[model samples]
Target: MSTNTPTPGGPSLPQERRLVTAIPGPKSQELQARKTAAVASGVGTTLPVYITAAGGGVLVDVDGNSLIDLGSGIAVTTVGNSAPRVVQAVQDQVAAFTHTCFMVTPYAGYVEVAEALNRLTPGDHEKRTALFNSGAEAVENAVKIARTHTKKTGVVVFDHAYHGRTNLTMAMTAKSMPYKSGFGPFASDVYRAPLSYPFRDDQLDGATAAARAIDVIEKQVGADNLAALVIEPIQGEGGFIVPAAGFLPALQDWCTANNVVFIADEVQTGFARTGAMFAVDHDQVVPDIIVTAKGIAGGLPLSAVTGRTEMMDSAHVGGLGGTYGGNPLACAAALAVLETIEADGLVDRAAKIGSLMTSRLHALQERDSRLGDVRGRGAMIAVELVKAGTTEPDADLTKQVAAAAHQAGVVVLTCGTYGNVLRFLPPLSISDELLEDACNVLDDVFAATK
Candidate 1:
């Protein structure tokens, strides 16, 4: 809960930061040894092995490696890890009591979070909110609400989108290797459409790109048969793609005309990750159901489906929610996160990160032929690695660049259909100095690779 910056007399050497033993450091290696002996191999992991503590943009690994966390624990720390207000709220809530599942005994924290979601989520129309344990659950509930409201079964998603890892969400998701490899026969009636990938598709303009994708649904899926069209306003794991300007409004229009419930999966882009409270706000487009997670509760596990009141009310009284949907600790953290974002101007901070990243990455592209594209909205940005002067993907190069950055004390993540994009999500509270340092590390990796 203390300020992320070191106290008056902070350690000269980062505590639990990058130092001492190898990357996995001696202590981390021992922990890893124990983990391998005890944990399941199926559960995947990213670099730097382990973390002992985290605050602001830095992660202190078990081996004392202090890493600039660009991934934000897969986009969960947008308000920064251990934010003071969030920490205080969490501690205070924990001291009072932990859980009395809303289903059993209703609580104020749950109602407060729902009220906040109702107030913040897009749509001037009346809306309602329902909480869940994970983004997947929120998504599932959204679909259920859609189907229940419209009395239809079909839901539309996009290729290269990463929804979640659950059965139904696996069906909603487009990736295969890790999420949907052996997970299906997944939930049925989920359809996939083409995304407006400006770097990859040259035949159409942004408007045409949106129309082309809509045409497929019109002719193949048939709007009459669809209950919802769910999309990421700014695709997250799907290469951090930000659709062209007209793309979102077109989709929303199509959804409006067809009476299809348009759902914006802002799991990664919500809560100022995209510089706006919700990425859909970028286009001034509102959806029928807006699902949120990741940074919604700071580092806590909490997600929600915030949608128009009528549509949300379509489901019967007992159709939604879970045992841990609005756990008090997570609710307290969510409230604090909202307060922190407003008080600290994190939305603007997200916007500034976007401008900085675009400038830096654009410069990198100008000099390196292997850098094919620099894209994304707000702080959720990425650089696509390609074979020099070609559209051909270079996942290998992506791995090397990210690995090198990790070795250099910065953390980065790779995502895309081809796994060739390096995505960034440094905490909004990170200092300009720390940000420049991380950017310099990226620049060094680029120079080395080029």
Candidate 2:
């Protein structure tokens, strides 16, 4: 419905949204049946559409539907799916060598990625980096390094935080239903503090919220025993809750005073996805350690924990690293991703995307009372759905709205601890026209649901 045209330099795929059949169509339904038989029930998909190809702002399903991509594969394809740079880098690296094990035989690509992360992450202090396979691995290793550096065992996390699904990260996470349901006997010495959820916290100021959380940490965990305080600059899975202005800086100050390492879990908010290279850049808060993944390697599975040189060096020789950690192919992809981000000015692009999304969503909110709160920054934005007359979360409405959007050929994702948040994470390379089209679809769906 949008008349705007695709911008130049995006992927070559047709930049449009089209639905030829019902939501899943017939082919996708058949594949869904096969998936049901072959895949475990534990693995669930947001949409049953079988995607055969994706590029620019569209996901081409097996059924021949060109669905506008707004999730970016959970914010992994910041440079866009199959980006030219990433594809070329991977192809060249694969031709040369797939894997020789970084632990056994080091490669220049790995070192290059580490050097890039060290130079890009917030703060100019001398830093070190350790590459891993995923965000969970990077987070676990960050904890290990923090403990080693501070000689303490306690780590403090925040409410509504979605760290990871690993044993250690599960303990660090706050949600229980899907992430930490059956798993039990989680790691010890982990603490949860309150976060600054402005909409739900009665509009508490950032400084007051920080004081309240710090009070709990000092009394319950004791700052003396705290080795690190880990938090997401803008939470990802627990809804895109951007903490108040002073919350992060105050927490960083507390960590510095207590000799506790401050860890920024920027896994879902890093690599120019949040307007800035990192979300901490928004508040000018420098974290002692920052964990990054998702958009780091342009869809490749590569994560890193970059931090102060001393903290990173505290770990003993070979205390970190795994068999496939920092695979050569992934490292090469990361290098190209970094280059693409810098050259294409994706940081500024993210800001423009944020402005477009926020302006559109805010306009919709003015008309729909059920749209509770519109929040987030850059390409990562979300709307909390609630009952029309009250603030009570309306998860059913959220589901209906998302289903309607998917049926109409828009790929949207729902998140948040309350299951009432609809999030949009479009690729930075998405055309303005395609983005407007997706929003138009969302507008219709929301109106119909109401």
Best by TM-score, which number? 2
> Each prediction's Cα lDDT score?
0.85, 0.93
lDDT by residue (1-450, candidate 2, tens digit) is 533355444567777787788989999999999999999999999999998998888899998999889999999999999999999999999999999999999999999999999999999999999999999999999999999999999999999999999999999999898999999999999999999999999999999999999999999999999999999999998989998889999999999999999999999999999899999999999999999999988888899999999999999999999999899999999999999999999999999999999999999999999999999999999999999968999999999999999999999999999999999999998988888888888889988886
TM-score of 1: 0.95
Give the winner by lDDT: 2
lDDT of 2 at 400: 95
Clashing pairs for model 1 are 16-64, 17-64, 17-65, 17-66, 18-65, 18-66, 127-309
lDDT (C-alpha) at residue 341 in model 1: 88
Off by over 4 Å in 1: 1-18
